[model samples]
Target: MKNHVLRPLWVAILLVIALLVARKLYVPADFGINGRNFTYGYYRKASVNDWKEFKVKYKGRQYCKECHEENFDSISKSKHRIIQCENCHGPAIDHPDNPEALEIDRSRGLCLRCHADLPYPGSHRNDLPAIDPEEHNPDKACADCHNPHKPDLEG
Candidate 1:
């Protein structure tokens, strides 16, 4: 090739070689593909220990059910059975275990997360009941007029 093309090709080759050399020095010893059987082919082996020590925020519905059987039973029977308690109640980081009530989010925005009326043509969102947030009592919280445990019923 001519000097014009040859010069650019040589610079490109040198850049790739420099990148490989820099990666060898900068990359951690434990971060790479251990084998074909390693997690996702390429993974850091130390991440497993990191995950083990990580504190989980949201405990499952069963965790809430351990103490609040009455409320849990009500939710389980209602259409909200598909929804997790922590979805509206925030994370149950240390609920009954720490004897602290989970923070219940009574904001209209919380209900609007699923209940906002945005029904489009040929969509599955129609299954969940939709409401006009502004028209359906702008001043009051949905929980004030409707019980989430029995959401279809009025308060």
Candidate 2:
């Protein structure tokens, strides 16, 4: 009876020891180093080359200003001054070298993300005009009447 109980206990201890040994051998050497978590170290090691090769696609408004000074100037003076170029146009990563115009996102839903009227009081900024998309202009896109660079429908 004693041997039967001891046999299972010994097996359980060995199994735990094997698992610890496997973890030590297989886990990253930098795991949990310098207050970093295990997952961070694991991914950092696994995709080190991917991280190194990663290029920032969104090169900020200043980068766009270098090539599109006219548009930048217009936007600077307009209500959309706070909006970044990459917010409407996709990232300009290889745009300088490749020289292809970015396909503008002209989707109505994109415009409505900010402009759509919400019943929740004071959810949007006071200056930003909100409209019920279905009621405001059922078939028309915002760009149909409003200039994106200078986004005032009346002006």
Point to the candidate with the largest lDDT. Answer: 1
lDDT of 1: 0.85
Return the TM-score for candidate 2, rounded to 2 decimals.
0.66
TM-score of each: 0.70, 0.66
Give the Cα-based TM-score of candidate 1 against the true structure: 0.70
Candidate 1 regions exceeding 4 Å error are 1-32, 36-43, 97-101
Q: Between which residue pairs do clashes occur in model 1?
A: none
- Cα lDDT tens digits, model 1, 1-155, are 66897899999999999999999999988887777666567878888889999999888989888888998998888888899989988799977666566778889999898789987778777677998988999999887778898888742
lDDT (Cα atoms) of all candidates against the true structure: 0.85, 0.81
For every model shown, the clashing-pair count is: 0, 0
Show where candidate 2 strays beyond 4 Å.
1-53, 125-127
Q: What are the per-residue Cα lDDT tens digits for candidate 2 across 58-145?
A: 8999988987899999999998898899988888878877767676799998888888876676655444688988898889877888
